[model samples]
Target: MNENQKLALVTGANKGIGRAAADQLAALGMTVLIGARDARRGEEAAAAVRAEGGDAYAIVLDVTDPATIEEAARWIEGSYGRLDVLINNAGITGSGRVSPAEAIDQIPSTVDLDMVRAVFETNVFGVIAVTNAMLPLLRRSPAPRIVNVSSGGGSLAIASDPDGPFTGLPTSAAYSPSKTALNALTVQYANELRKEGFLINAAAPGYVATDINNHSGFLTPAQGATVLVRLATLDADGPTAGFFSADGPVPW
Candidate 1:
């Protein structure tokens, strides 16, 4: 990689919003590392990006697997020496469908503890593991940025309000709570790293049509990725310790 070119790693980049984010980042002149748990899927996604004239490579990284996370960190260090941007886009919604009726599987009243653990394992704890593993490499960069993909459903401000848009959506104990935890985690990281010239923030990509929701969402993956790409390529003066969507700052 060129000394001047930025290297970005997007977790869960084999499909959906993560894939779109990788493509967009590469188009912006950044060498994007597509992190996916599955090797074949990662390679296929990377090849597609390259076909579109983007600098992208597949990197086998499963956020839920510490061994893979550690290996990915070492590989990145050996390859590029430093990471300019880190997009924690890998996540899971726990169950197949999240409609009002289907959401019962994740309802707090009788949700399986294992299901909650599994959800947090990927959505929350996985991000922590990956971020910590990549910290050293990120420290080497003159300007490092981290974007944690969150969700509007996790917003307590909106959820607490009676007439909020999220009120109509089904209640979730696994996915929603995990994202809320992620938002809190994002703030803590940004607060700790702000002095070091790191722009760390959470992005709530409005409901996008993807496998996570069975394609029930209205927005396309590309539309959902816009905020992620924006947050990943922020200027030095860009906001940190904040939650944002494409529209603007998301309520806490």
Candidate 2:
């Protein structure tokens, strides 16, 4: 509430990795805004953070809803005056599975153009919309950070290499491509905002257990959110326009 208090916004934070990221950021003394499409879930997540003695608030933010995005920006502008961190964690798996054996041709070969478009609508365009809408407020902070939640499956270096880990993995025309675009967008935005001292980077949380994969992952949501939180709270010297994971830099 005070000018000195740092404010952060984490989208799709009703549960899973987003919620964990919000919790970690709040624990670090940030006034976190839990952005969820469902108002009830958002408030519940915020309450959970409060129970942990963290400063948090709920805001209805359906990434695909332009009206809600505008409303959220207005609310932050009026209430916080400035935003120190923006975590674009809202994402969908599109129409594919990440299993190792699932082949590229097995997926809906026709690749629902609509599904691909819809995936980009949320995973790609939504990020751009939300970031552009909040750029003004982000500029108000002396130190600003933007963390785009991306995935290893989006790594072109791995996808293109014959000997790479992901080379033999299944592919989806939707999800993977959308995330690749997201990584590129992250780089472009970070480059543009570098002079403003805004640390913008894309992070892959590794394969985490969540509904997206039917809980097939080895890691937990907490583990996934750790890298995200680290990027969210980076110092001025932290890397920008880069792609990373828990272990180290992920091929971009």
Candidate 3:
């Protein structure tokens, strides 16, 4: 391992946008840790990146599982001694791949409380767990960055607008609101760590073709990953506590 090389960890990197972000970071010469709940899938994803001549490794990490999270942190601390970038990409939509008509499950008034809790567990609480666990290692680096993968669906400004593009999309209390909470959490974290030089921000990857949406989205995974990669690789003077997309700053 080159002492000067940076280490980046992308949670839930076995497939979709997470995998694409990992691949991009590896291509940029940063050693990327592919975090997946399934060990075999994680290894396969890492192998795919390694085949492309990038330094990548597989780490079994289920963000909702405290044991795996702690173990991952311990392994990273022992092996790399420090972490430069942390991308909280692991999340669940609660209801998988629902079409517009099927989005009734997420309707706020009749939504299941259990479903909402489960979504928050992974999308919100999970980020807090992983970020806090990795903070010690992140602090050891000269330039540390944290990118919380959010969604444009979480934008209240956009969602509330009757004329907005997302107005046609089905209302989602579970998935969309979870992301909004995640955005709030990101801002709080950024405020707490600003003086320490940590650039923590939220990234809203526009509707992309992935398992979460059953490949119904128009944008490719690589396209959705652009903002995540950009924010993760920001310079010291870059903005923090902001929500951004591939084009520019998104409404809060």
**What's the CA RMSD for each of the models?**
1.1, 1.7, 1.0
lDDT of candidate 2 at residue 25, scale 0 to 100 = 87
Candidate 3: residue 5 lDDT (0-100): 97
Compared with the true structure, what per-residue lDDT tens digits does model 2 show for residues 1-252?
Answer: 677888999999989899999888888888999999999999999999999999999999999999999999999988878999999999986554555455353254767678788889999999999999999999999999999999987898887889877665666787888899999999999989999899999999988888767778899899999999999888889999999998888878
lDDT of 3 by residue, 99-130 (tens): 44457789888989999999999999999999
Candidate 3 residue spans exceeding 4 A from truth: 98-101
Clashes of each: 0, 0, 0
- Better candidate number, 1 or 2, judged by lDDT: 1
Report the C-alpha lDDT of model 1 over 1-252, residue by residue, as the tens digit.
699999999999999999999989998899999999999999999999999999999999999889999999999999999999999999887886544445768878888889999999999999999999999999999989999999987899987788987666567889889989999999999999999999999999897888867888889999999999999989999999999999999998
Model 3 has an lDDT value of 0.94
Which 10-residue span in candidate 3 carries the lowest summed lDDT? 95-104
Per lDDT, the best of the predicted structures is 3
State every prediction's TM-score relative to the real structure.
Answer: 0.97, 0.95, 0.98
Best of the candidates, TM-score: 3
Error of 3 at 217 (Å): 1.1
User: Which order, best to worst by TM-score?
Assistant: 3, 1, 2
The global C-alpha lDDT for each of the candidates, from Candidate 1 onward, is 0.92, 0.89, 0.94
